[model samples]
Target: MEVICLEDAAFYTLIETVVERIKEKLSTTEDKWIGGEEAMRKLRITSKTTLQKLRDEGKIRFSQPEKKIILYDVDSINEYLEEHAKERF
Candidate 1:
């Protein structure tokens, strides 16, 4: 085995760099809106009608900034899945 050491300042800098990278990764993954196709893929569904149904029924959250453009909330989709998840014995 080889030994390596970092000084106090260097060690703190390294830790800060790692924390910043983690924050970047988390912010990217926590995207607030996704297009219909991506939302469907994440929910493992193939029907636009079904997706619309869920949106219409208020089972999921979505936004329509324009008449024809829609974006689903990622957090709402995740919550929906967790709420409907089946329990195991």
Candidate 2:
């Protein structure tokens, strides 16, 4: 019984570690980019003005085409998360 529990715990830990690694890889993929609505959802913010503010502040890494549409890089998003994650309100 104890041995079974230990094996289960090890399996859970290994799974968690693999999941974390995959998440990191996905987050850092240079070609990975999400559109506006999904990006906003991930960031947990809905302010159009706030998005603009980030652009103006150069806090977000994005590409512009035509006149108005903005596309954000996944790695940049990850970097932003890492930078802002240290603070909590």
Candidate 3:
């Protein structure tokens, strides 16, 4: 086995490159969780209250893993849109 050594600057560049690659991979992965703000944007709503009401009424599914942050399942949001879509015939 051979040992490879890097100088200070080289080591930092390697670390930075690794970090960037990891970020790219994560960002490109299938995002299954949609944050509250993103969901509102997708639904063209301007208020979190509207989303909260839907959550409270069980009209939409959501998860609050933390005290202040909520995430909705992308599939559920898509289903809600389909259910509420207007037909143009």
State residue 49's C-alpha deviation in candidate 3, in Å.
Answer: 0.9
Q: What is the C-alpha RMSD of each candidate to the true structure, in Å?
A: 2.6, 7.4, 9.2
Compose the digit string of candidate 1's lDDT tens values, residues 1-89: 99889999999999999999999988775569999999999899999999999999999999999999999999999999999999999
Please tell me which predicted candidate would have the highest TM-score against the true structure: 1
Candidate 3, residues 11-49, lDDT tens digits: the string is 999999999999998889547888988889878899889
- List the lowest-lDDT window of 10 residues for candidate 3: 25-34
The lDDT, on a scale of 0 to 1, for candidate 2 is: 0.76
**Which residue pairs show collisions in model 3?**
none
- The top-ranked prediction according to lDDT is 1
lDDT of 2 by residue, 1-89 (tens): 35544588899998999999999988874357666776676677898788768767888777876477778766777788888887556
Alpha-carbon error at 56 in model 3, in Å? 0.8
Q: Model 1, which residues run further than 4 Å from truth?
A: 1-27
C-alpha root-mean-square deviation, candidate 3:
9.2
